[model samples]
Target: MERRLKISSGERLLDRALDEGIALEQECGGKLACASCRVVVLQGMHHLVAASEDEVDMLERAGASAPNARLACQVRGTGDIVIEIPDAELPPACAASSPVRVTPRAARHLAAQLNKHAGAVAVRLAVERSGCSGFSYRIDPAGAIGDGDAVFESHGVRIAVDAASLPYVQGTLLDLVREGLAHRLQIDNPNVRESCGCGKSFSARSS
Candidate 1:
């Protein structure tokens, strides 16, 4: 089954959804920990299964609207559903523009942090074999610069991707978010398949 959801202004729902070819955001790969992929069910409420306690807890932290907001990771599609993106529920990292044409929110949040800290931090983007989707991201504060690495600067922060991983992450963006008491890094990648529920693994779709 398939579902359709609408994103508010400055949201990248369509881009991220099409890239993964799924109607869910498996942040933490889908671990149900980070609620970055939560969505509101504007229509077809009866089609979805009841929200589990864990999902409800996550939704509470996600600041989702009562009786409507649901985690995309948890709401398995039955036939089709219509969802509206809310700003209050919007992932913190979503923004309007990015240099790499990736998701803007994550990059914007990271940029804000860099500005506040005024410290040098390395952003390394890489893919690892793990998670429900068969792969996940490996993000770390870069320590050393390697030769022939592709680097892009956003909001005065330098993000580097290894030559090998560049293709997989091309046109991807990063964002930092604070949902309730939980804070996390979000990735909006154009090259990803279904991510595990744990947000630690993912699989790439075939060309």
Candidate 2:
């Protein structure tokens, strides 16, 4: 479908779509964590904010190769733009099985950590393009749930993973490991094909 949207100085494209009753699948709640709301910008690319590294990563994960393809969830700025929403371009949803698993020990540790952080809702799990092996894992306490976050519970703690990161980290297990007197969390991802010798990152198998 074709639409011409004149956004305010800093209006998010996704919000405008919602206001106009347009159907855009924003599986990450406009968190820049998914590509479900991708649109091909036929005009006015210069008026929008430059895409961030995270958004680019998500687009790459979604296999969006077109130079003008932008995620509506992350497109916010001034001016008028013409965009095309391709019906068959939306990425598929995550698998039915839980993409990530947290062990009891890890859940206990995470739950305690969440208590320490102010207003922490769930533990956010994500993959960033970094380290020598192409990707690295990141875990942080999420203060609020995004609209498109894939939430799961293990033991008694909740975990949230953005839809974009779910594809690369599926079948992964989070656990706590103790070495000597120090304790650290570990990620056991079944999708890893190669690990950096420095133990800092890994390359995931194609989804």
Best prediction by lDDT: 2
CA lDDT of each prediction against the hidden true structure? 0.59, 0.81
Q: After superposition, how far is residue 111 of candidate 2 from its true place, in Å?
A: 0.7
User: By how many angstroms RMSD does model 1 differ from the true structure?
Assistant: 13.5
Q: lDDT tens string, model 1, 1-207?
A: 335654333334434355546545455876788887776676866666787866765664443435688776666545445775554645332222222332245556556654555344656677766656776677665765679677777545678778766666665656556789986776666567567767677676422
lDDT of 2 by residue, 64-123 (tens): 657899999888999999888887764333333435667667888999999999999999
RMSD (Å) per prediction:
13.5, 16.0
TM agreement with the true structure for every prediction: 0.44, 0.53
Q: Residue 4 of model 1: what lDDT?
A: 67
Q: Which 10 residues in a row give candidate 1 its minimum summed lDDT?
A: 93-102
Superposition TM-score, candidate 1 onto the true structure? 0.44
Q: Quick one: best TM-score, which candidate?
A: 2
Number of clashes in model 2? 3
